[model samples]
Target: MPTDTQILAAIDAAFGDSPRPEHFTHYRHCCECAEHDELLRHRDRETLQHADVGNAGWDPICFCSPEGIAYYFPALARFALAEPVPELDWYGWQMVFHLDYGGAENPFFQHCAPQQRQAVAGLLAHLLETRTGLLEMDADSALRAHGVWAG
Candidate 1:
């Protein structure tokens, strides 16, 4: 897997220089986002403690809050492992996509056009592929390379 720094860099690159302030605010708190300042503080944890605050049926484990979903889905979609993508089951995914593409519930929608939304989706898909490739490697070596595991 990419190091947390690498992941955050990727997210920043994906969002580019023109990210809206509201989007940046939401992204900073999203659990799935490595750029989330809170995540950086809890780097030793294997997973998020309360990821599903906004989930409808199943409880999520990270930033599962509505805001989390709205801000993180694009990034998460890139790393989803299951075929057809797991976000399909989460209402937050739809909401985020709609908002990013043109839906008005979020102020970020004011800054994003369909093209930018599509670009974000594509970048997220690439990040997911990179995450999957990293997962396919042996854990010990991968973790060592990222300097995230000592054991």
Candidate 2:
């Protein structure tokens, strides 16, 4: 498991040349999001295992995948803060219930207007873009730093 400091360092190194205010801001947000996703994934995975062993009453929790850490977490933070209402595709709807309402019930789903949903969708999109951009940036930086840019 990478420590937060290490992750941040990697992010910094990845973006050192092109570091913008947005990069730093998104990096911080991504770290927090990753932590949240990790907590959720751990809890969910444990609950699933327990259920498989006949513990039906086990509390379900979320578990973060490396991909989740790299992607979803930051996206969620942006979405929640911005409170955008986006069109619900199948996956998006699932995310709302599976992720957004996994352990705790969110009143936002019930009370949010159409505009709110749109905002949420926009936030999700932003998160996805940030995650993709970070990964690409990191990969490019790693190649250059290691003198493997040609490969």
Off by over 4 Å in 2: 1-99, 102-105, 133-151
Per-residue lDDT of 147 in model 2: 28
Q: Model 1 Cα RMSD, Å?
A: 13.8
TM-score of candidate 2 to 2 decimals: 0.23
TM-score per prediction, in order, is 0.29, 0.23
Q: What is the lDDT of residue 94 in candidate 2?
A: 27
lDDT of 1: 0.37
What global local distance difference test value does model 2 have?
A: 0.31
Model 1 residue 47 lDDT score: 40
Task: Please give the CA lDDT of all the candidate structures.
Answer: 0.37, 0.31
| lDDT by residue for model 2 (1-151), tens | 3433443344333323321111211223466545443444443211322121111122111333323322333333322223223432222222333334422233333333344334344433433443444334243332222221111
Give the per-residue lDDT of model 1 (tens digit) for 1-151. 4444454455445444432223322445445453443442342122433232224333332322334333443344332322333444433233233333323443443444555444444444433345445344333333322221111
Deviation from native of the Cα of residue 19 in model 2, angstroms: 36
Error of 1 at 120 (Å): 3.7
